[model samples]
Target: MELRVGTLNLASGRDGGGRSVDAAGLRAALADVDADVLAVQEVDVGQPRSHGVDQPAEVAAALGASDWRFAAAVTGTPDPFRSWTPVDPPVLRASWETLTGPHYGIALVSRLPVRRWSVLPLGAGRAKLPLQAPDPRTGETRWWWFPDEPRLAIAAELEHATVVSTHLSFAPHTALRQLTRLRRWCARLPGPVVLAGDLNLVGPVPARVFGAPRLVSEPSYPAPGPRVQFDHLLGRVAASRPEVRRLTIGDHRLVTVSVHPG
Candidate 1:
């Protein structure tokens, strides 16, 4: 069986003018990918930034998926302007109180059949870190220090194999530890799993750090002129080369791969 999986970081659906693009624009951008399973990071839910669009729901609609989950990592926004609180006992959509602020985290959507779902929590990095962002006025890259929020990976049991989506910490050592933990977690799950996400690890470091084959290799960051590949799709299963494509919504490109399992 073959499964098409995609991973992308949604920058709150910003357009060329650095303005919000509603659900229609988001659907339009996803028209070509046609992934059976898609994992997205840096996602916003009930947030003013993306016009309060439930991004995961819209993305699931675009993919014609019936199973989807937005793994909420924080209760508030993580930008320099606002403070965020870690989500305790992270599972939601089961039974939980209304989130205090706009939620930001990673998500997973699947057009394929699902048996069960699971979430693995990776604690937040110890300190704030400088992240590069493009200046709104000049379009020049600028460094801004922002607090690190808690991280987690959402895994789904698909028909053919288990699938996982995650976003690791920007802190190098922390990310490395998370990767190791993630690898071990996947090892215990059902056989022939596909792990997809923005690992924040460069080049072959992620593969070497663990021992999974990275399905995609080309640089996917800074979409226009790529330099380093911070995005990855790793598994021991056979897979075709991914189509690393760019969207107007995010700084990083999306990677979609086709996995084959016997």
Candidate 2:
């Protein structure tokens, strides 16, 4: 059976303006594509900035997925320096307590029944990245030093394939290191594997590092007029090369891929 997979950076479910996340609009947009497995980044859980929305749950419900998992990369607000608290889970578990503040992370939602799941921590003892922050006085974005936030790869074993979802660091070196570790880890898993996420790198960087062919190529950032193809889907499964399409859902463009297993 052909499986439809997708990946998107939700930007905390906010539109381009970062004003608010319209759950209805998101649901409607997702319902239009109806992918079997969806991987999303920048999802929020009980976050004030996004109005304490359980973004994964909302999206899963919207898509009518049977199973969904969220691995928290940061435990507090979005600001990495001010209030962000990194969470390091020993194992990938489904349950998460309602945190006092906001929780930011990646999520995977699957319509296919999940056989098992695992979470790999890739943010240990890494140096912080300089983020562009808005200047309070001039309303301009400036580079500011912030702690290297935690990153995780959530692997879900479905009936036919093992799908891994991850969001890597913006820093090139850190992302490359994490990609290496991820390749090593996925090697131990059984069956064919499909790796999907926002790698934060351009061109064939991930394909070369992971030794997997990119299933599709499409620009998925800065929704209005995307110029970079940051989001990707790469895998070892023998299938037709997927064609990625962009769906405008609020502020960000949701990228979807369709794979037909041979």
Candidate 3:
């Protein structure tokens, strides 16, 4: 079977005007990727900012996936950083309030059954450098935003393979440490692995440090006319080569890939 994987920005819930994310536009964008499993970035679980839409669940329902899981990079309330927290998961008839209830950071959506799951934390502290993009005030170069904690890596074990997704820090040094943590995690897995998300590497750091291939040749941030490649899909393919794509719809782009089993 041809397994499709997708990584989308989801605009972190709105456009420049701070409007709600377009549900129809989001559904259309998801349909365009049509991946078997999807890795989403900037998803708003229970924020009023997103108009009470549990982004991952809504998208999964729209796509009719048999299974889905979310790992929140940030939560709606204060920060303590626990191993796991309980919240009402999203469902078909789940209300906007229910749908938009508190959510885990990052997430994994799949058509196949997920046998197991775990969340890995990458420690903080590293240099963040802003990129030069087309913006009015800054006119180009902007400072990179570093989260309180390093980026997260969420993994799931399935009947056939293991897949992971995370948003890497924009800081080069921080990103390198994050990738190193990811490598250590990958070393302990017992099956084929596919890692995807916003890599934030514009240069050769990905190849040099991660030992994974860049699925596409384009930038994922700055929406319209992206000049830097921040998102990525990578991993070991066993006896097969990974198939990755950089999909652009309107002002957003998604990076998706598939790893064939040996």
lDDT of each: 0.80, 0.75, 0.60
Q: How would the candidate models be sorted by TM-score, starting from the highest? A: 1, 2, 3
lDDT of 2 by residue, 90-191 (tens): 334363434455577899989889999889999843576666644322324468776666789999898878889998887888889999999999998866
Cα shift from native, residue 27, model 2 (Å): 2.1
Q: For residue 236, what is the lDDT in candidate 2?
A: 68
lDDT for 248 (candidate 1): 75
On residues 17-104, what C-alpha lDDT tens digit does candidate 3 reach at each position?
Answer: 4354556655655665567777766565765445556777777876767777666555443222222233323222212224334553
Residue-wise C-alpha lDDT for candidate 1, range 1-262, written one tens digit per residue:
8899889988666665656578899888877667899988987777766777777777888888877888888765444523677778887441113444578788899887788889999887877777665432333446877777789999989877998999999898999999999989989888788888999999999988768888888899978888999989888888886799888777789889999977
Worst 10 residues of 3 by lDDT: 132-141
Give candidate 2 regions above 4 Å deviation: 78-80, 90-101, 124-146, 240-243, 248-252
Model 3 misplaced stretches (Cα beyond 4 Å): 15-18, 22-25, 77-104, 126-150, 238-252
| Candidate 1 deviant stretches above 4 angstroms | 78-82, 92-101, 132-143
lDDT of 3: 0.60
Instruction: Please name the candidate that would achieve the greatest lDDT relative to the true structure.
Output: 1
TM-score of each: 0.90, 0.86, 0.74
Q: In model 2, what are the clashing residue pairs, if there are any?
A: 16-251, 128-148
Every model: Cα RMSD to truth: 3.2, 3.5, 6.5
TM-score of 2: 0.86
